[model samples]
Target: MTEKVLIIDDDTNLLSGIQRQFRNKFDISVAEGGEKALDMVRSEGPFAVVICDMRMPGMHGVEVLGSLKEHAPDTVRMMLTGNADQLTAIEAINEGNIFRFFTKPCPSDVLAKGIEAGLEQYRLVTAEKELLRKTLAGSVMVLTDVLSMIDTDIFGKSTRLRDWARLLAGHLKLPQPWILDLSVMLSRIGWVAIPAEVREKFKSGESLSKKENEMIQRIPETGKKWISHIPRLEPVAEIVFYQNKGFDGSGFPDDEIAGKDIPLESRVLKVLNDLAGISQDTAPTKLDFRQLDLQAQLYDPEIVQIVRQSLPKADAENRDLYFETAEVPLNLLIAGYELLSDIETKDGKLILAKHQQLTKTLLTKLRNIGEIQGIKEPIRVRKHIVRKV
Candidate 1:
């Protein structure tokens, strides 16, 4: 694919000259001012490099490039200006994070070389991001799959928590919502450390001894330890670490951090976890809103309000949404379908729970397990239903 470059300048003549200079070599886009440049960056971006004139009509090049750094950090940035004062250069380098600084009288050859270097930098940055994303994603999948194999109840809880987390994150308009989603999915991973008999007993709502209760209480800490070793999962680890913390400085691991001091993601997770637990016991009704309201000290009050407002909408959406149920052979089962009923092992142990959304990795593992241990046929799934407008 041809690499894209964007040039922004107040001078239309200069813009035209630069476009003509590099149009043949690179796919070039031009913006007259900083505002338009930012608009283009948002809409038609992922440009390999962006060249901005330091002095512009509305927004300074430094401001524009600084904003770009926040919006698209991987896009290489450069600043060009006639005024090459020391302060201008300093601000451009410090604030804008410009990859290259050039004067207006800069030779075409020099500018061309800078563009080439900037594109190279962009390539390196994006390549590293892609690698990290894939590696972290794969590791998470492996961990969750292990959880599914060891204890499907925990896996099912994670899946449900993931769905609720996504909805909450979306409602709040949080950036990169996937981080919250991933945090929720892996939040229960520490349960693996508990003995299988203990886990089963806990699942059955059996009263636990003091030692067993302590072991259960330590699951979040154990999960944090597991997540901390993985590269690029520090945020996830932090979220998981504080999942049990309360808004009023109450709850396990006994950290004094409370209220806004807790990460927003953690606060959101705590409320959702409580709500999910409540729903599992009994279907939440409007009357239950009072119970949640009474528990305000336990959650971020603002987030609690958002959840209250969101629940009715969620209910309406769920009611309107319809899924076509179908029974498919184990080998033919595809990912992204919701399980309508529990999938159990030949010995009647639950392998996957109802309402869990299947994933590619989960499906592949299930297939492998089936081939080894003979799974029953006609696995029930809720087929993806596309609503008519």
Candidate 2:
């Protein structure tokens, strides 16, 4: 990727001279004043670095750079000024988060070094964000994949929720959709502590003992505890912690954080979690939001409206995949095919839940379980080659 640079100044001569002098050394774009520069940043940006003259006709450097801080926050901002007073430096640093301040007669070589430094800073900022976005999220995903081996149903539901979360978020044009996606995927991480029988009873809609109910109620906080320990996942942890919070402020943690004061992603998850519950009781293709509509006080109306429109479409998309399924025996089982029904023993004990994708770990578990308990032959599955879920 090119490390594109933008230089903003009112002097056409200076702009042209700078462009010419460093055109070979850097990728350069120039704007005569702040307004035009902002327009460029909005329309053609992801600029690696921006250097601006301190004083101009309108939208002085501090103001322009402050705006840039909002628009292209990752871009390294630097200033060149004839008035290099302490007050100017303080204001620039406070407002613009300037990377470097240069005096008016900055040598070409010195300016070159500063710009290079700014570019390096930009690279570090972006690279760290990418690591957090990809690598950190990846590590979290591996943990969830382990969850799949433990409880296929929870993992399967989370996977399904991710489909809806991404779809609804896209239709609504929400920023940072990945945050919502991660929240949905990790929504059930709290269930890791619950004994298999307790989780099963809860899933089967069996009434739980008071102690069991308390354990179940703590799932979100448990999720928050495990996830919050990771660096920079605190927002995701907050969303996980608040997934069960009611839009009308009637749910747990016993706080007054009602309505939109609840995190928006949590609101999105609240609606989606209820929808996943409803889907559990019905056909995936007929997944309904009307039940959620009746409980409007518990959800964000906007998110419910979008889910009502988008979820059936997401379900319909996978209907064809189910239509082309196959039933394979234990010896023939392979990774990447999705289970369409629960895998059980010859004696009729449930071994793995339905809607789970076969993984090497799962396949090994099935085979070992087969050797010991004898798996039922011809397990029903769909060939899952599309690389989703």
Candidate 3:
């Protein structure tokens, strides 16, 4: 909600005068030159609007704003110059994505109006992206929730993979972490095509017949195809497709893609998925660590260590900072709350397990199940509210 604006000009007098004139109306900060403006962007940024003088020493307005386009993409950029040349204006618009161009000695009121318009445009565009993400996320969750109902084990593991991926992601720099999130959320969706009995046997560590094995082998490809059709999800599909591929280049959908060639998110997911599956009942500690060590060559060693670090911290964080248990009715359940106890039928048959986060998709599944099978009332859950620093 910050309406912060930054004005950059080599002329200190002009910069100070502009600040004084509009300081009461806007949250304005003045930078003496391009370098100072960029520094402020890195240190104190996400400004809603930035205005730069076109003729600054060493760096021109186009260069400054072009760099800003990459560094703070959502910030609206404007250009001001005494020249008012057509070439400068064209280059500014094409290179810097400039929102407004002003010649020197522009009326203060006109400049203020332009600044206001730029701020509103920034707000509108960012809001639309946010809305699209949430709406898309909700729609995707519907698919995951359906998978959960059909195969609880796979869906639960996918959720665990998502949490573990998040922890590992903190140690790495990913341009699009949400791609990993979407990748993990729908990681096991490919398994939905396999027969329930086959999936159950796999979970029980039983060997599958040749035909059964073939179906299981094709899961990653099946998942990739289904996801790729969605717009803006191509990267997500790639992550999912490679989720089972070994970091050492040794797993299914066999190809030459190996060692760092595989998507990093997939490698992290691969480790976490196997780590969780090795012995689900045991504490996520040394027990899982020793098991992963046995299959060490199958994963990225650095990512393996990241998972190792995540174990104790995640357990402690959940118990101390996140979990607050409450027994609430099904209708009161909210997305993001983790179940602390098993959701089961009135006859005590297990439905959803403890520690599974309630998502909107799962909420719908819970409602449908409540109506159809009649679940136990006052469900036990841990409302996951992170304690702020």
Candidate 4:
């Protein structure tokens, strides 16, 4: 596919000459005036470059250049003028974002070089933007994975945190570099600093000692330390640090900053965090004393009331299953697929396929060869067959 080049000019001879010069190098498109040029830009751009001639009838080159900038800002703008006067150059720079300014009869080599440079610039800018987007996405994914390892208990609990954060950001009309609900996500990264024994203790319904409790309280500081190296993640770190603080200036690190002073994202995070905590341990069951204890202690009273009022009755609908059981060992099968798939018996040693699925199944078979094992109920496995992509 050839790159389409649009040349806008009223002078027919000049247009023909320029078109001929680069006809072999480009797939060319042309328009005679500003309105037509704008139409071409709207309909056919993402052109690599747009070259316009100054001193045309009706709308001047600068005006056309400005319109091009507005319509297709990424399309590099080059001005061709008979005069290289100070005012015209300044106006082209300020108003047109001119990529390269050329006096009339621009040398072919110079114009070619400028065109090449402009295209390269466009590619670099585009690549840089794409890389940044991927980087941000990768960072979020890394954060999610880290959180998963930190506390598998709450790993998938905050599924809707990002959606709620985006919604709250829109409602609060957050500015660019939006700062909102990262507090909830990064909040649990502090759990990494906590000993596994502490987590196990919680699972076993044991309370932490006073010193252990104090150490747990400082977990957010650990999170801040870890994320401080990432400049873009720093704002999220700040929000994570203050997640325990309340909306009414009643909670930790006493600054008495209430209401809006509490970043909207942090406030949203606090609500979502409570919602997730309740969802994980209490789903499929009605709210009980434990849920109430968390609500009263961990959440803003107004926010809690809002959640209760807004709680959808449809949510009471039961899901298929909550926990993995032998009857639903399909998830484990998916994880251990490679291990179960291949196995070889050697002298007192077994070599399984790099695939685990076959190995897992064989192990299960040998372990329960005569006695009933994993026989309570059979699990359903869904398999799809498709041609190779």
Which candidate would rank higher by lDDT, 1 or 4? Answer: 1
What digit string (tens of lDDT, one per residue) describes model 2 on residues 134-179? 9866876677777887877776677667767776887876646778
User: How good is model 1 by TM-score?
Assistant: 0.78
Summarize candidate 4's per-residue lDDT along 182-217 as a digit string, tens digits: 455566677777788987686567998998878777
For all predicted structures, in order, the TM-scores are: 0.78, 0.82, 0.82, 0.48
By TM-score, how accurate is candidate 4? 0.48
Better of 2 and 3 by lDDT: 2
Give the TM-score (vs. native) of candidate 2.
0.82
For model 4 the local lDDT of residue 369 reads 27
Whole-model Cα lDDT of every candidate shown, in order: 0.82, 0.84, 0.83, 0.61
Local error of candidate 4 at 99, Å? 8.0
Error of 1 at 163 (Å): 3.6
Strongest candidate by lDDT = 2
Candidate 1 lDDT over 1-389, as tens digits, reads: 36799999999999899889887877889999999999998778778899999888889899999999999888899999999999999999999999999998889999999999998888898788778777766777777866776676667667767666666776887756768877988888888889988998897999999999999999999999988987778999999999989899999769789889998989988887777666632124565556677778989999888887765432434644765678988888888777767777676756787767788877876887787776766788867678889
Q: Write the per-residue lDDT of candidate 3 for residues 268-290, one digit (tens) a residue.
A: 77887787777553236676778
lDDT of 4 at 276: 55
The per-candidate count of clashes, in order, stands at 0, 0, 0, 18
